[model samples]
Target: MKIYSLINEFSSLDPCVFTLGIFDGVHIGHQKIIKNLILRSRKKYCSVLLTFHPHPKEILNTNKKFFYLNTLSERIYNLKKTGIEHLIVHPFTTNFSKLRTKDFLKKILHPKSKIRKIITGYDSIIGKNRDSSYEELKKISHKYGIKVYKVNPYKFQKKIVSSTHIRESLLLGNIQWANRALGYFYTLSGNVIEGKGIGKMINFPTANLQIDSKKLIPKQGVYAVKINYLNNMYLGMLNIGINPTLEKENRKIKIEVHIFDFFENIYGKKIDILMIRIIREEKKFNSIQELKKQICMDKINIQKFFSCEKKIR
Candidate 1:
């Protein structure tokens, strides 16, 4: 797919069918809309996907903290798999957020732009104060001879599949349910960093990860996960919590993973952790021996879980 940094850079004169959204996570709901967009564009239109950079919320809501399911690079990677012909990553500034509905449409749907149609989700809204509904969009686009279509909500197990719902599930350590909603394993990518070597003393040496601050972290717990390093996959167990047993006063959360049957110096390498299931919540143990004993049991359980998973597959 060809990517443009601005809408004006998309100089193609062919009629285009486009959809615009942050598309965080690119979950099932967003997939449904993209599927429709591709189908509609197959005949005479080129499929275009327009997204914003730095996320609009980051600029508009300075006081509130927002976590993203995927970083900008990850979002682009996921969207590329959807087979869209063109992608426009427009710069989202405070001034751009102030554009009225009609003005925004005019910028993208003007006669010279050749935007034949727009596909949006049922709940999509845009423009100043986000007051433009589908009806409003259709009315304004009509003047530019553009058609608007809205994709119905996609649901799983009778519940709407959304990025917010997936985030909530992850925050609650419901990895299995979150994976179902995401249509894939939830992944956290980061670089390996030096740690205190406490796990090594217990014969469970871990690779500490330095994750992106903007990425959303799952609930603090020990989890069964698969680690991807240098294009290779390995089974592992990850912990996302403060080491209460080893530290008395330190409370900062740490993310470390123990890859089973693997040993190598990966202090500065990047890896992707795909969360599978939560093994247990973080707890304070009375001694290092007690913590080691619990981790041994967790390892056994995770091994059995993966063994059964292989059988089922």
Candidate 2:
């Protein structure tokens, strides 16, 4: 897929079918809309996806903590897998947010432009103050001769699948529900960094990860996960929390993973952690021995879990 940092950089004159959104996780709901877009564009038109960088929430919700399900690069990577021909990641700023619904449509969907159709989720709204609904969009786009299509909400277990719901699930450590909504495992990618070597002392050395602050972290807990390093997958257990047993004075959250039966130096290397299931919530232990004992049990249970998962597959 070809990616452009700005809408103006996309100079293709070929008529295109496009959809625009933050598309943070590219979850099932977003996938359904994109699928419709690609189907509508097949052979006759190019399939285009337009997303915003830094997310609109980051710019507008200045007083609230806004965490993104995927970083800009991760979102691009996920979108590429859906067979989009072109992606426009427009820079979002205060000025851009001020564009009224009609003016925004005129700029991007003018009668002279090549964008022929737009596919969007059923509930999607845009423009200043999010005042434009699907009905409003259709009315405005009619003047520009652009067609509009709305994909019904995608649902799993009777609940609507959405990025917001997935984020809530992750924050609550509801991995199964989140994964079901996403249609894939929730992933966190970062570089390995030096740590206090406390895991090593317990015979379960870990690779400390330095993740982007803007990326949403799951609830503080120990979890069963799969690690991707150098394109190889390994079973592992990850802990996302402060080490209360070892560091009484420190309260900063830490993310560390111990790959079973693997002991290669990976400091400074990047790895992707795919969350599978939550094991247990992080807590303070009475002593180092107590913490080590609990971790041993965690490894055993996680191994069994993977074994059963393999059998089910």
Candidate 1 residue 113 Cα shift, in angstroms, is 2.3
lDDT tens string, model 2, 15-128?
999898889999989999989999999999999988888788899899998999998888999999999999999998989989886677667776578988989886666678
Q: Which stretches of candidate 2 lie over 4 Å from their true place?
A: none
Candidate 1 lDDT over residue span 160-236, tens digit each: 98888998999999988889888789999999999998878899999999999999999999999999999999999
Worst 10-residue stretch by lDDT in candidate 2? 125-134
TM-score of each: 0.96, 0.97
